[model samples]
Target: MIGFYGDIVFETSNSRILTFSELQRSTASRWAKHEVIGKKPTSEFIGPDLDTVSFTVNLNGQYGVHPRDEMNRWLIKARSGTAETFVIGNKRIGVDKWVVKSVSQMWGVILNKGEVVTGKVDIELEEYVERL
Candidate 1:
Protein backbone atom coordinates (compact mmCIF):
# COMPACT_ATOMS: atom_id res chain seq x y z
CA MET A 1 0.00 0.00 0.00
CA ILE A 2 1.08 3.51 -0.77
CA GLY A 3 1.42 5.43 2.42
CA PHE A 4 1.43 9.21 2.62
CA TYR A 5 4.05 10.58 4.92
CA GLY A 6 4.89 13.94 6.50
CA ASP A 7 8.12 15.83 6.86
CA ILE A 8 10.88 13.92 8.61
CA VAL A 9 12.68 15.83 11.35
CA PHE A 10 16.15 14.88 12.46
CA GLU A 11 17.07 15.76 16.03
CA THR A 12 20.62 16.31 17.03
CA SER A 13 21.84 15.50 20.51
CA ASN A 14 21.90 19.24 21.22
CA SER A 15 18.18 19.48 20.45
CA ARG A 16 18.00 21.33 17.18
CA ILE A 17 14.73 20.67 15.38
CA LEU A 18 15.16 20.91 11.62
CA THR A 19 11.90 21.07 9.71
CA PHE A 20 12.42 20.44 6.07
CA SER A 21 10.64 22.67 3.61
CA GLU A 22 11.69 20.51 0.68
CA LEU A 23 13.66 17.36 1.17
CA GLN A 24 15.56 16.63 -1.99
CA ARG A 25 16.72 13.12 -1.17
CA SER A 26 17.82 10.63 1.48
CA THR A 27 19.82 7.39 1.06
CA ALA A 28 20.81 4.43 3.22
CA SER A 29 23.29 1.76 2.15
CA ARG A 30 23.47 -1.76 3.53
CA TRP A 31 26.68 -3.29 4.81
CA ALA A 32 26.75 -7.02 4.04
CA LYS A 33 27.40 -8.70 0.70
CA HIS A 34 27.73 -12.16 -0.72
CA GLU A 35 31.04 -13.30 -2.09
CA VAL A 36 31.84 -16.11 -4.52
CA ILE A 37 34.38 -18.73 -3.49
CA GLY A 38 36.48 -20.88 -5.84
CA LYS A 39 33.52 -23.05 -6.80
CA LYS A 40 30.36 -21.75 -5.20
CA PRO A 41 28.91 -18.62 -3.62
CA THR A 42 29.75 -17.87 -0.05
CA SER A 43 27.38 -16.68 2.64
CA GLU A 44 26.88 -13.04 3.30
CA PHE A 45 29.93 -11.54 4.93
CA ILE A 46 28.89 -8.73 7.24
CA GLY A 47 31.21 -6.40 9.02
CA PRO A 48 30.83 -3.91 11.81
CA ASP A 49 30.53 -1.14 9.25
CA LEU A 50 27.53 0.98 9.99
CA ASP A 51 24.93 1.82 7.40
CA THR A 52 25.37 5.21 5.73
CA VAL A 53 22.54 7.68 5.93
CA SER A 54 22.68 10.87 3.93
CA PHE A 55 20.11 13.45 2.90
CA THR A 56 19.49 17.07 1.96
CA VAL A 57 17.00 18.96 4.08
CA ASN A 58 15.44 22.35 3.39
CA LEU A 59 14.45 25.09 5.85
CA ASN A 60 12.47 27.44 3.71
CA GLY A 61 8.75 28.37 3.84
CA GLN A 62 8.62 28.12 7.57
CA TYR A 63 6.94 30.83 9.63
CA GLY A 64 7.05 31.80 13.32
CA VAL A 65 10.25 29.85 13.68
CA HIS A 66 13.73 31.17 14.06
CA PRO A 67 14.94 33.79 11.63
CA ARG A 68 17.37 33.13 8.85
CA ASP A 69 20.43 34.06 10.85
CA GLU A 70 19.33 31.86 13.74
CA MET A 71 18.79 28.97 11.38
CA ASN A 72 22.28 29.47 10.07
CA ARG A 73 23.61 29.37 13.59
CA TRP A 74 21.89 26.10 14.27
CA LEU A 75 23.38 24.62 11.15
CA ILE A 76 26.81 25.56 12.33
CA LYS A 77 26.10 24.29 15.81
CA ALA A 78 25.16 20.86 14.46
CA ARG A 79 28.73 20.05 13.61
CA SER A 80 29.65 19.42 17.23
CA GLY A 81 30.68 15.87 18.00
CA THR A 82 27.50 14.30 19.26
CA ALA A 83 25.04 11.57 18.35
CA GLU A 84 21.83 12.49 16.57
CA THR A 85 18.62 10.59 15.85
CA PHE A 86 15.70 10.65 13.46
CA VAL A 87 12.07 11.53 13.97
CA ILE A 88 9.73 10.11 11.35
CA GLY A 89 5.99 10.77 11.56
CA ASN A 90 6.58 12.72 14.76
CA LYS A 91 7.51 9.50 16.53
CA ARG A 92 10.75 9.31 18.46
CA ILE A 93 12.60 6.58 16.63
CA GLY A 94 16.09 7.00 18.03
CA VAL A 95 17.50 3.69 16.91
CA ASP A 96 19.95 5.16 14.41
CA LYS A 97 22.74 7.43 15.54
CA TRP A 98 23.97 10.07 13.09
CA VAL A 99 26.66 12.68 12.82
CA VAL A 100 26.58 15.74 10.64
CA LYS A 101 28.89 15.45 7.68
CA SER A 102 28.20 18.76 6.01
CA VAL A 103 25.77 21.63 5.87
CA SER A 104 25.54 23.79 2.76
CA GLN A 105 23.02 26.48 2.06
CA MET A 106 20.64 25.84 -0.81
CA TRP A 107 20.16 29.02 -2.81
CA GLY A 108 16.51 30.00 -2.90
CA VAL A 109 16.50 33.37 -1.22
CA ILE A 110 13.26 35.24 -1.60
CA LEU A 111 13.73 38.97 -1.33
CA ASN A 112 11.40 41.63 -0.01
CA LYS A 113 12.71 45.11 -0.75
CA GLY A 114 16.24 43.88 -1.14
CA GLU A 115 16.13 42.00 2.18
CA VAL A 116 16.09 38.28 2.63
CA VAL A 117 12.61 36.88 3.01
CA THR A 118 13.17 33.16 3.39
CA GLY A 119 16.07 30.78 3.22
CA LYS A 120 16.87 27.10 3.09
CA VAL A 121 19.60 24.69 4.12
CA ASP A 122 21.02 21.57 2.53
CA ILE A 123 22.62 19.24 5.02
CA GLU A 124 24.31 15.87 4.81
CA LEU A 125 24.57 13.37 7.66
CA GLU A 126 26.28 10.02 8.07
CA GLU A 127 25.34 7.19 10.36
CA TYR A 128 27.79 7.11 13.27
CA VAL A 129 29.49 4.44 15.29
CA GLU A 130 32.29 4.51 17.82
CA ARG A 131 34.31 1.71 16.31
CA LEU A 132 34.39 -0.60 13.34
Candidate 2:
Protein backbone atom coordinates (compact mmCIF):
# COMPACT_ATOMS: atom_id res chain seq x y z
CA MET A 1 0.00 0.00 0.00
CA ILE A 2 1.45 3.37 -0.96
CA GLY A 3 -0.86 5.51 1.15
CA PHE A 4 -4.39 5.98 2.40
CA TYR A 5 -6.93 8.66 3.05
CA GLY A 6 -9.19 7.42 5.82
CA ASP A 7 -10.42 4.04 4.59
CA ILE A 8 -9.67 4.72 0.93
CA VAL A 9 -6.44 3.05 0.03
CA PHE A 10 -4.21 4.16 -2.84
CA GLU A 11 -2.77 1.14 -4.49
CA THR A 12 -2.34 -0.78 -7.75
CA SER A 13 -3.44 -4.35 -8.21
CA ASN A 14 -5.32 -6.67 -10.48
CA SER A 15 -8.63 -5.69 -8.93
CA ARG A 16 -8.04 -1.96 -8.35
CA ILE A 17 -6.15 0.65 -10.26
CA LEU A 18 -5.66 3.66 -8.02
CA THR A 19 -2.30 5.41 -8.01
CA PHE A 20 -1.30 9.01 -7.42
CA SER A 21 1.41 11.24 -8.85
CA GLU A 22 2.57 14.82 -8.98
CA LEU A 23 2.12 15.08 -5.24
CA GLN A 24 2.59 18.55 -3.81
CA ARG A 25 2.51 20.05 -0.34
CA SER A 26 2.00 23.64 0.71
CA THR A 27 2.43 25.45 4.04
CA ALA A 28 2.59 28.99 5.23
CA SER A 29 3.11 31.25 8.20
CA ARG A 30 0.72 34.00 9.19
CA TRP A 31 2.26 37.45 9.31
CA ALA A 32 0.91 40.90 9.95
CA LYS A 33 2.41 44.21 8.97
CA HIS A 34 2.10 47.20 11.26
CA GLU A 35 2.84 50.75 10.18
CA VAL A 36 5.23 52.62 12.41
CA ILE A 37 5.06 56.36 13.02
CA GLY A 38 7.13 58.05 10.32
CA LYS A 39 9.06 54.85 9.77
CA LYS A 40 8.96 51.68 7.78
CA PRO A 41 6.37 49.04 8.47
CA THR A 42 7.19 46.15 10.74
CA SER A 43 6.14 42.62 10.16
CA GLU A 44 5.10 40.37 13.00
CA PHE A 45 4.73 36.64 12.86
CA ILE A 46 1.34 35.57 14.01
CA GLY A 47 1.31 31.81 13.68
CA PRO A 48 1.50 28.95 11.26
CA ASP A 49 -1.14 28.57 8.63
CA LEU A 50 -2.85 25.34 7.79
CA ASP A 51 -0.97 22.99 5.48
CA THR A 52 -2.40 21.65 2.26
CA VAL A 53 -1.70 18.66 0.04
CA SER A 54 -2.57 17.93 -3.56
CA PHE A 55 -2.06 15.07 -5.99
CA THR A 56 -3.21 13.61 -9.28
CA VAL A 57 -4.60 10.13 -9.76
CA ASN A 58 -4.85 8.27 -13.03
CA LEU A 59 -7.78 5.91 -13.38
CA ASN A 60 -8.05 3.37 -16.17
CA GLY A 61 -10.72 0.76 -16.77
CA GLN A 62 -8.13 -1.72 -17.98
CA TYR A 63 -6.59 -1.61 -14.53
CA GLY A 64 -9.93 -2.36 -12.87
CA VAL A 65 -10.80 1.17 -11.80
CA HIS A 66 -14.33 2.49 -12.09
CA PRO A 67 -13.93 6.21 -12.64
CA ARG A 68 -17.49 7.22 -11.87
CA ASP A 69 -17.59 5.31 -8.64
CA GLU A 70 -14.27 6.76 -7.52
CA MET A 71 -15.31 10.25 -8.42
CA ASN A 72 -18.56 9.93 -6.49
CA ARG A 73 -16.72 8.72 -3.43
CA TRP A 74 -14.45 11.74 -3.45
CA LEU A 75 -17.38 14.06 -3.94
CA ILE A 76 -19.22 12.49 -1.04
CA LYS A 77 -16.31 13.02 1.29
CA ALA A 78 -15.86 16.61 0.20
CA ARG A 79 -19.51 17.39 0.75
CA SER A 80 -19.71 15.68 4.13
CA GLY A 81 -17.05 17.89 5.79
CA THR A 82 -15.46 14.88 7.36
CA ALA A 83 -11.89 14.74 8.65
CA GLU A 84 -9.79 11.72 7.80
CA THR A 85 -6.30 10.56 8.51
CA PHE A 86 -3.87 10.99 5.64
CA VAL A 87 -0.91 8.68 5.66
CA ILE A 88 1.84 7.84 3.17
CA GLY A 89 4.17 4.95 3.57
CA ASN A 90 3.41 4.64 7.27
CA LYS A 91 3.92 8.35 7.92
CA ARG A 92 1.21 10.86 8.66
CA ILE A 93 0.91 13.76 6.22
CA GLY A 94 0.51 16.66 8.60
CA VAL A 95 0.45 17.48 12.29
CA ASP A 96 -3.19 16.47 12.42
CA LYS A 97 -5.72 14.74 10.22
CA TRP A 98 -7.02 16.15 6.97
CA VAL A 99 -10.22 17.00 5.13
CA VAL A 100 -11.03 16.79 1.46
CA LYS A 101 -10.99 20.35 0.23
CA SER A 102 -11.70 19.90 -3.45
CA VAL A 103 -11.65 17.45 -6.32
CA SER A 104 -11.21 18.03 -10.05
CA GLN A 105 -11.68 15.36 -12.69
CA MET A 106 -10.94 15.03 -16.39
CA TRP A 107 -11.91 12.17 -18.64
CA GLY A 108 -9.21 11.33 -21.13
CA VAL A 109 -10.97 8.38 -22.74
CA ILE A 110 -14.64 7.40 -22.88
CA LEU A 111 -16.36 4.42 -24.45
CA ASN A 112 -19.26 4.62 -26.82
CA LYS A 113 -21.64 3.61 -24.02
CA GLY A 114 -20.54 6.63 -21.92
CA GLU A 115 -18.19 4.69 -19.71
CA VAL A 116 -14.98 6.36 -18.73
CA VAL A 117 -12.12 4.21 -19.96
CA THR A 118 -9.37 6.49 -18.72
CA GLY A 119 -9.44 9.55 -16.49
CA LYS A 120 -7.39 11.81 -14.29
CA VAL A 121 -8.44 13.25 -10.98
CA ASP A 122 -6.88 15.96 -8.88
CA ILE A 123 -7.52 16.06 -5.15
CA GLU A 124 -6.80 18.80 -2.67
CA LEU A 125 -6.55 18.25 1.06
CA GLU A 126 -6.26 20.61 4.00
CA GLU A 127 -5.10 20.08 7.53
CA TYR A 128 -7.78 19.40 10.14
CA VAL A 129 -7.00 20.76 13.57
CA GLU A 130 -9.36 19.98 16.43
CA ARG A 131 -10.35 22.55 19.02
CA LEU A 132 -8.13 22.61 22.03
Candidate 3:
Protein backbone atom coordinates (compact mmCIF):
# COMPACT_ATOMS: atom_id res chain seq x y z
CA MET A 1 0.00 0.00 0.00
CA ILE A 2 0.99 3.65 -0.47
CA GLY A 3 1.98 5.92 2.41
CA PHE A 4 0.42 8.81 4.29
CA TYR A 5 1.32 12.12 5.86
CA GLY A 6 -0.50 12.90 9.07
CA ASP A 7 -3.68 10.83 8.82
CA ILE A 8 -3.95 10.63 5.05
CA VAL A 9 -3.08 7.67 2.84
CA PHE A 10 -3.34 6.92 -0.87
CA GLU A 11 -4.88 3.51 -1.39
CA THR A 12 -3.61 1.97 -4.63
CA SER A 13 -4.70 -1.61 -4.15
CA ASN A 14 -8.08 -2.65 -5.51
CA SER A 15 -8.56 -4.60 -2.31
CA ARG A 16 -8.17 -1.89 0.34
CA ILE A 17 -4.69 -0.78 1.49
CA LEU A 18 -3.03 1.93 -0.55
CA THR A 19 0.53 1.50 -1.83
CA PHE A 20 3.13 3.78 -3.27
CA SER A 21 3.28 4.37 -6.98
CA GLU A 22 6.86 5.60 -6.79
CA LEU A 23 9.08 6.42 -3.86
CA GLN A 24 12.47 8.16 -3.68
CA ARG A 25 14.45 8.75 -0.55
CA SER A 26 17.48 10.89 0.29
CA THR A 27 20.56 9.44 1.93
CA ALA A 28 21.27 9.64 5.63
CA SER A 29 22.11 13.02 7.15
CA ARG A 30 25.47 14.01 8.58
CA TRP A 31 26.63 16.50 11.19
CA ALA A 32 29.38 19.12 11.01
CA LYS A 33 30.62 21.87 13.26
CA HIS A 34 31.88 25.17 11.95
CA GLU A 35 34.10 27.63 13.73
CA VAL A 36 36.29 30.62 12.94
CA ILE A 37 39.79 29.63 11.97
CA GLY A 38 41.92 32.76 12.04
CA LYS A 39 45.09 31.23 13.47
CA LYS A 40 45.00 27.53 14.36
CA PRO A 41 42.95 24.62 13.03
CA THR A 42 39.31 24.57 14.07
CA SER A 43 38.64 21.59 16.23
CA GLU A 44 35.08 21.47 17.52
CA PHE A 45 34.07 17.99 16.55
CA ILE A 46 32.01 16.86 19.47
CA GLY A 47 29.72 14.30 17.89
CA PRO A 48 27.23 13.85 15.08
CA ASP A 49 23.75 15.28 15.06
CA LEU A 50 20.35 13.74 14.55
CA ASP A 51 19.74 12.00 11.26
CA THR A 52 17.30 13.39 8.70
CA VAL A 53 15.58 11.36 6.03
CA SER A 54 13.74 12.72 2.99
CA PHE A 55 11.20 10.94 0.85
CA THR A 56 9.38 11.80 -2.35
CA VAL A 57 6.26 9.82 -3.17
CA ASN A 58 4.48 9.99 -6.48
CA LEU A 59 0.72 9.76 -6.65
CA ASN A 60 -0.29 8.52 -10.04
CA GLY A 61 -2.38 5.94 -11.86
CA GLN A 62 -5.30 4.03 -10.29
CA TYR A 63 -4.39 3.57 -6.65
CA GLY A 64 -5.81 4.74 -3.38
CA VAL A 65 -7.91 7.91 -2.94
CA HIS A 66 -6.85 11.13 -4.62
CA PRO A 67 -4.31 12.89 -2.39
CA ARG A 68 -5.62 16.32 -3.32
CA ASP A 69 -7.19 16.86 0.08
CA GLU A 70 -3.98 16.32 2.02
CA MET A 71 -1.97 18.31 -0.48
CA ASN A 72 -4.28 21.29 -0.03
CA ARG A 73 -4.04 21.18 3.72
CA TRP A 74 -0.28 20.66 3.62
CA LEU A 75 0.37 24.18 2.42
CA ILE A 76 -1.03 25.63 5.58
CA LYS A 77 0.27 22.87 7.82
CA ALA A 78 3.84 23.29 6.67
CA ARG A 79 4.04 26.75 8.14
CA SER A 80 2.66 25.64 11.46
CA GLY A 81 5.39 22.99 11.87
CA THR A 82 2.89 20.19 11.69
CA ALA A 83 4.57 16.93 12.63
CA GLU A 84 3.21 13.59 11.48
CA THR A 85 3.98 9.89 11.41
CA PHE A 86 5.52 8.56 8.16
CA VAL A 87 5.33 4.96 7.02
CA ILE A 88 6.56 3.64 3.66
CA GLY A 89 5.92 -0.09 3.56
CA ASN A 90 7.95 -1.53 6.46
CA LYS A 91 8.94 1.68 8.20
CA ARG A 92 11.66 1.69 10.85
CA ILE A 93 10.84 2.82 14.35
CA GLY A 94 12.00 6.28 15.64
CA VAL A 95 11.19 7.44 12.15
CA ASP A 96 8.22 9.36 13.39
CA LYS A 97 7.15 12.99 13.80
CA TRP A 98 7.62 13.97 10.22
CA VAL A 99 6.68 17.20 8.47
CA VAL A 100 6.07 18.30 4.90
CA LYS A 101 8.97 20.30 3.49
CA SER A 102 7.75 20.99 -0.01
CA VAL A 103 5.30 19.90 -2.72
CA SER A 104 5.30 19.89 -6.51
CA GLN A 105 2.07 19.30 -8.40
CA MET A 106 2.34 18.40 -12.07
CA TRP A 107 -0.58 18.51 -14.44
CA GLY A 108 -0.17 16.08 -17.27
CA VAL A 109 -3.49 16.36 -19.14
CA ILE A 110 -5.99 19.13 -18.74
CA LEU A 111 -9.47 19.17 -20.17
CA ASN A 112 -11.13 22.02 -22.02
CA LYS A 113 -12.96 22.81 -18.83
CA GLY A 114 -9.59 23.63 -17.19
CA GLU A 115 -9.77 20.53 -15.04
CA VAL A 116 -6.86 18.20 -14.64
CA VAL A 117 -7.81 14.81 -16.01
CA THR A 118 -4.40 13.38 -15.26
CA GLY A 119 -1.88 14.68 -12.78
CA LYS A 120 0.73 13.60 -10.29
CA VAL A 121 1.57 14.78 -6.80
CA ASP A 122 5.12 14.85 -5.43
CA ILE A 123 5.46 15.22 -1.70
CA GLU A 124 8.66 15.90 0.28
CA LEU A 125 8.92 14.74 3.86
CA GLU A 126 11.55 15.62 6.49
CA GLU A 127 12.31 13.86 9.73
CA TYR A 128 11.91 16.11 12.76
CA VAL A 129 13.28 15.46 16.20
CA GLU A 130 12.85 17.47 19.38
CA ARG A 131 16.40 17.23 20.71
CA LEU A 132 19.82 16.13 19.51
Q: Indicate which candidate wins on lDDT.
A: 2
Per-residue CA lDDT of model 1 for 13-126, tens digit only, reads 333444544433354444555666676655554454445443454443344334466456546546565656655554533346666666676446657654444566665555
Model 3 alpha-carbon drift over 4 Å, by segment: 15-22, 27-43, 49-56, 60-64, 67-70, 90-94
Question: TM per model?
Answer: 0.51, 0.94, 0.63
Quote model 2's TM-score: 0.94
lDDT of 2 by residue, 5-58 (tens): 997899877687698999999999999999999999999999999999999888
RMSD of each: 7.8, 1.1, 4.0
Ranking by TM-score: 2, 3, 1
TM-score (C-alpha, index-matched) for candidate 3: 0.63
- Residue pairs clashing in model 1 are none
Give the local distance difference test score of model 1.
Answer: 0.49
Instruction: Rank the candidate models, highest lDDT first.
Output: 2, 3, 1
Q: On residues 1-132, what C-alpha lDDT tens digit does candidate 3 reach at each position? A: 445566666455554433444455564434455666686545565554443444444443344434454345556666777887776555742555777777676766555666444455566667677655
- Candidate 1 vs 3: which has more lDDT: 3
